[model samples]
Target: MLRFVSFTLAIVAMCNGQIAVERDPVCGTRNGFYGIEGNCDAYVECRDYRSREMQCPDGLHFDPAVAWPNYPCGYPMEVDCAGRGIAQPAQPSAECPHLYGFFPSPKATADECGYYRMCVDGVAVEMACPPGLAFNPSNARCDWPDTVSTCNAAAFLGFTCPPPPVNEIGELIEGPVNYKYEGNCFAFFSCEEGRARLLSCDAGYGFDPISGRCVDGDIIKC
Candidate 1:
């Protein structure tokens, strides 16, 4: 767990070896933001020889590359906290792994791939992806389950994509293809990169395997 301390207080606390803060060219020599030693989420603001410690918001880190007065902080993924390795301790909740970010739902099941949790200032809010899509934690967005490792596309949709067609030489044909999802008139399987992704037709429409497209639901037999 990381701790934040003002520049002055840090010097005093260093003796205990509990928290190590950077001590360098004193602040107030220049009007700008300076990175705190060993702390990625904290910086010192200098104005007219006056200094005040500042901290980036939750889930963000100080970006020395950014200039002053323009908000020199950014998301941890975007900022490179190389030497300055320390960060604020995570404030986790039952539904939130961090104070601000998207996380997989704790209650998600094999069939419930669309559920996710959004954390804002330590508060957790449950969210769900639209039908035919699954919550992807890698990129923090809703995507096809086949492309998301955590969600097994075949198990979730109870369908598997068949092997791709091959030519006379037995070379795998590479292209997009669709297949009907058995027992579900509204859904189908879209195959890409040898993975099966479950897709759905719009309201009042059903998948037509013969035509390989969605058609009017009234004319399609379930």
Candidate 2:
């Protein structure tokens, strides 16, 4: 009986290992292999393979549990599929957004997580997000940054002229540099003497130093 019990445990261990190898999404190693952390869903998380802590793949890393495919770079958001900004069931006829206009094949099963498809742009490559994420037509892709907060950051564009140096004139202060938080563009500037300041607008349109060039003080328009 003890011999039989030992054999059963061995079989179970073998099966689990096999599944881990086959289920590995990134690199499929042969029978005696383990996995490491990767952006792709199929990869197993092996912390130390042979003494070295596995670094994140070239373009991938472990994502926070808060977001699916947690390492956020640019994955389509759910709203791209359904017109409404609500989560919808993943269906067979589901169409994905294109990079320029091309997209990957439909998911075989909802469990697949994400898809890898062609980019419509001339890049001629395939991109992917975690399963369930989709491109947003309103913003163009799942990975597009949120614009609302970006737009709000325009408030940061206040005023600061002298460009520092205690009180030096003719310093040829550098023109405003545009810095964006999300989609919004705020001004960033450096003085010729090495001081910096922020530029902003009050009423109508116009920002300090270089006033009223672009409306609404936006560094990036839309």
Indicate which candidate wins on TM-score.
1
**Model 1, span 1-222: residue lDDT tens:** 235446657777777675743444566455689888889989988775467899987777899888777888886557867778789987776656777777788777767788898788778888998766888888778898877878867777677777887889999877868899877899888887778777789999999999889999998988
Clashes of 1: 0
Q: State TM-scores per candidate.
A: 0.59, 0.18
lDDT by residue (tens digit), candidate 2, 34-107: 22322231223322222222322222222223232243222333212223222222222223332234343344
lDDT scores in order:
0.79, 0.33
Runs in model 2 deviating more than 4 A are: 1-56, 69-194, 207-222
Q: Which candidate is the best by lDDT?
A: 1
Provide backbone clash counts, one per model. 0, 17
Q: Clashes in model 1: which pairs?
A: none
Worst 10 residues of 1 by lDDT: 20-29
So what's the TM-score on candidate 1?
A: 0.59
lDDT of 2 at 122: 29
